[model samples]
Target: MRIDWDVPITMDDGVVLRADIFRPVEPGEYATIMSMGPYAKGLSFQEGYPGNWNRMIEAYPEIAEGTTNKYQNWELVDPEKWVPDGYVCVRIDSRGAGRSHGHLDPFSPRETKDFYECIEWAATQEWSNGRIGLLGISYYAINQWQVAGLRPPHLAAICVWEGSADYYREMSRHGGILCEFLGSWFQRQVVRVQHGTGERGPRSPVTGELAAGPETLSEEELAANRINPGQDILDRPLDGDYYRDRSPDFSKITVPLLSSGNWGGQGLHPRGNLEGYLAVPSEQKWLEMHGDTHFSPFYTDHGIALQKRFFGHFLRDEDTGWTQQPPVELQVRHPGEKFVQRSENEWPLRRTRWTKYYLDPDGQALGTTPSSGADLSYETTGDGLTFLTPPLTDELEITGPVAAHLTLSSDTTDADVFLALRVFDPDGEEVTFIGSNDPSVPVGLGWLRASHRKLDTQRSLPHRPWHSHDEIWPLEPGVPVELDVEIWPTCIVVPAGYRIGLTVRGRDYENEGVMLPGAMYPMKGTGPFLHGNAQDRPAAIFGGVNTLHFTGGVAPYLLLPVIPG
Candidate 1:
């Protein structure tokens, strides 16, 4: 079906953000699906992000079938699918990215205002039926939370797929530890598509001018006009207003949303999706969790159907057979790269029997009860302690976010605790999964600085733990302090003959036999001392001789979200 594409909308600021509008040529109004973000609007899935796009298409071949691949953009709804279904799919280049004006700084307050304006503009178009919805993955998804909070009049609904809510926690810092993802991400992706001063890049197939603007400025003019704000991110290490402005205020977001999360996306995406789903005040919300390569399912036939169903209900006012659907749909992950579909009434499944395995210092094993009064202490830099369980006779599935409650005395005022969940086979070999950092790594991991363990009870959920970065709780030299460490969520199936183990250490988890494979994108290195490197973590910030005090009087345990067999 031939549809009108690459339509331009001039914002209030006189900056024209280009859009690819796909709608039926027949004289009929249709609901609209709009997305605005970086990652270039014209860059094809097969050409721009080949590694990710290829994996996605390979796993879901139907994505590439039956349509001209021209309308496919990175990390957003495929226009071909939505346009033919009596909906106009609109893709906009956010100001400063792709074919948009202004400087390239993501999640900036200014950019959010632009998004709000863009939404209203789309709503007023001749082809729009006064209803619009936001749909996309990652960048497009992340910003929806921010804009939805603004409560645009035309934003009828949103499908936030695998987007993060807390910028500092998910994107910048992991457990108060600085992640190199921001720096590497900026260098590799953002800079390339940044709006330039000249009429470069793919011209709008409709306008024939540069997709961004009247490309009249020189390269120097483009660079000079942009805001090079990378330094601000590096300087701010806490959850200050800078991060807050970029994050979504859950209270203000009331639009119906379908929040999607990935089971294996521990580093940046999954946590926020879960957080947004739970935190948003929207009573009309749904949660869908899936397992697969990060970028695949969002574009697949299965994923598209879900997106269309949700958008159709909200945007088109169509009874798309989605109302009776389960509120939560999870692609329950199984061993050997298999997935089973499961429906649930709510997240952290009501039947999720929260089991706590206490740390037995004497035998270094995880048990149901504490072995009273036996205090054991270990060097902060040493192997620390491992609490292991014997091989299970039956298959066990542990999914969702895990936490560790520790009662410990530290030698110094501050300490860092690194928690790792490892699966060991009968022969004692560690089971590893393909991680973004390392191809072969443990199933799940989490970390926390002992002093930074203050909890925000109001924000904390049973399955998800939220920390208050409001103040630091200093260690009392030798007095035992109770601390809870929040680990990123994961889904793993431990078959019979495999043991579940929790390793509490002072540093990051680096597999000695594995060299850090060059990531598809560059990431900051953790430094020489494997696990938590000392260079990235200095004595002043993370320096402290830590100790784990586990005894009979006080039980330190790992909280597991074990799904019933």
Candidate 2:
């Protein structure tokens, strides 16, 4: 392999960005796989993120197979895999991070422009063919959506692995609840690799120089140059131009895409992949969903095989038979921590049997129809309400997005509803699994601050309801309002003698079993909020005496996308 370091590409703004390219030793002409992001390029995976490296290697030994693991970095494609295949694998440190010059802020318009110019630059290089493709995980993947919309002339295709599309809806907030990940992530990861302080950052193994630029600026200059897009999100807690500028207008992205989403990434990654797949105007597209650690499957043999096949067909015109592959491939999850491979023509399957399970006000049972014309109310401080189905006589599968329509009244001006879809065995023990955020988690979860329940009609789907969080409508005390709760998608099978359940609470879902090892991040001042916690839900903003009101007159019901047996 040949390593080319300190490769400079001058952007339109005259900012010189740095890149590290890994290519085959005897390369004449080859397709280029590129990734640009903030995380320092020189930082080793094991040194920067030991937990992720350990988990990835533990799950897929093949990742450590073949060439040396020297080129492996966090959340980007492995050069070892691509370099051996007669392809040039390039990693660029975005401005303000790594060895790049200028202010550091991710997904900004300036960064997008830099990415667009970088693609064209890679295309015109002496060792390069005009065709270029983008491949990476998380940051690298997320930005692809932005740059693709810009439609760089030399860009051919992209593999967006575990990236979210809507910056506001997916990354900054959950069910209209503000997220603290922006601040927390910036402090923990972004700030460390930010450009500045002359040569303090790690040096590229291949270059022997800093990753961002030749020499870093002073702290004052670095801060002035760096832009914190996350802080903008926190400033504007609603859908506005600030968020839209960072979001990809799928209609503008015409490039073929292989979008891979994680079934476990309920917080941000999965929603983006799904949204991009459905919304992007591209005629040639594919979707793949899997269950595993966030960073594991993306770099695994299975993931690499799929990515190469897709890119080969698009960039190399290899005709690798990828066109014959299924459009949608899902690793359907089972109850016993197993994934069942299934392929379908479309998402939310066309033949989805939509079943409505009504909320019984009397016994808090979830049934096919309403039990009586009586109101069921619960305190905001108490277990709001629960509805359950009888034990299944046979194995039943449910695999899609879920929704709930509630007629609720609050003692205060607003209410917060937290919905959890759960499974229970014959012993009545609740079944849980490892979620993207929390290890001990439930099947599906959703949340909504009652005032932000207004739906965006054009964007709402049968299986998923999109909210118009652009504005809030406070409630009148004791006045009933209709709320459509969007329970994030999931796949599960309830065995015979097992029951399916739904819990409508005023707050987040708490693990009923043994607690996992981690500091608890909860809602309000109460227990940990597994779905949307306190960092995102300040009491002054969400604190209210919430109420779950139900009756036959109101017809509150939970919608289940059940896969008929």
Candidate 3:
């Protein structure tokens, strides 16, 4: 294989972006696989994320089977593996984050335009067959949706592996609540390797060049060059241009697409994949859901083969058995770390029995009958409430989006509600899974800030409440109002005698489970996807007691997508 280091490609605005290209030695116009992101293209996977890297390698030793794994980068296709398969792999560091020189504004229209221009450039390259396929995980995958919407002429297909498409709903804010992950992530990942870090940042082993940039700028200058997404998100409380600019218009994403999500990737990954598959106007689209650590599965043999098959069919017109692939593929989660692969024609499965388990506030139980009990109140700073179902009489499968309808009131003007769907064995032990980030994640999670409860009826599905975060309607203290909370989709199969539990809290969910040895963060139920920002949930406004009211001409229920055989 041939490797080109730091190939300069000038954008329309005259910013020269740097890309590393890997192609076959005897290449004669091959289809191109490209990724453009803030993550330094030159930074190796093992160096950028040592914790995840070591864990993935230990779990799947075969990931290092073939050619030297030296070229592998985080959330990107391994050029060593793909180049031999007759494809050119190109990785470009988006302007301002890596070796590229420019102002740093992630997910901005400027960056997307740069991606589109890069696609056109890659297609025209001598190693390209004029067909470009976008493939990556997380940040790399997120931009695929953005550029695809622009409908770049040379773009042929997209494989969005665990990417968040809705910047507001999935990433920055969840159910209109600020998620601290965005801010913390910027500081830990992006800013650390940002342009101008130079001598402070590590060098790429392959090229022996600074992974950031060549010049080291003063701290003040570096701060001035980029926008702080955390502060920006907090400044724009209401979703508008700020968030929309980062999100994708699914209707305009007409390319053949494979939107892959993780069942345990709460907070971000799941919603976008499901929404993209359901909303995209593309005639050929597929959705695949799985379970595991965020980056592990993508590099596994299973993931690489699936990606190659899709890109193979769309970019090179190869069969690769992709023509016979199902529109929706799911790795149904069973207790004890087992996943059963299943293929289906559509999401929410046509045979889904939409089950409504009414909430009995007094008894703290979920039953078939509506509650006739009194209102339940809990301190906003404490565990709100938990409603559980009786042990199941038979095996049950829940494989789609989940929702909750509740009547709530607070002594203050607003309330932030955090909901977690969990399962417990007859012995009373909680059944958790290895989430994308969190090690002990619940079955599903949902959040809603009472103020931003207005729904976009046109976009709201019975099992999914589409919040219109365009405006905020603060609550009237002591007045009960109904709220529809949309839970990120999940897939779980519970055996007989197991029980389902829904815990409503005022803060991020916590599981006192033992943290895995190499886990990045504490194995709390929510992982690093936290939302306890003091400014967002200030003491004065959201510190009062919150009430869950029912039985007085009011009913609260959990809407579950139960798939039956």
Clashing pairs in 1: 99-212, 372-552, 373-552, 507-532, 508-531, 508-532
Candidate 3, residues 373-404: lDDT per residue as tens digits?
A: 77889888887798999999999999898999
How far residue 407's Cα lies from its native spot in candidate 1, in Å, is 3.6
TM-scores, each model vs. reference: 0.88, 0.92, 0.98
Ranking by lDDT: 3, 2, 1
Q: CA lDDT, every prediction?
A: 0.75, 0.79, 0.90
Residue-pair clashes per candidate, as listed? 6, 12, 0
lDDT of 2 at 433: 66
Off by over 4 Å in 2: 197-221, 373-383, 512-541
Candidate 1 to truth, TM: 0.88
- Candidate 2 lDDT, tens digit per residue, 341-395? 9899998777779998887767678789766556766655567677888888899
Best candidate according to TM-score? 3
Model 2 worst lDDT run, 10 consecutive residues: 520-529
| Cα error, candidate 2, residue 507 (Å) | 2.9
After superposition, candidate 3 runs with Cα above 4 Å error:
513-520
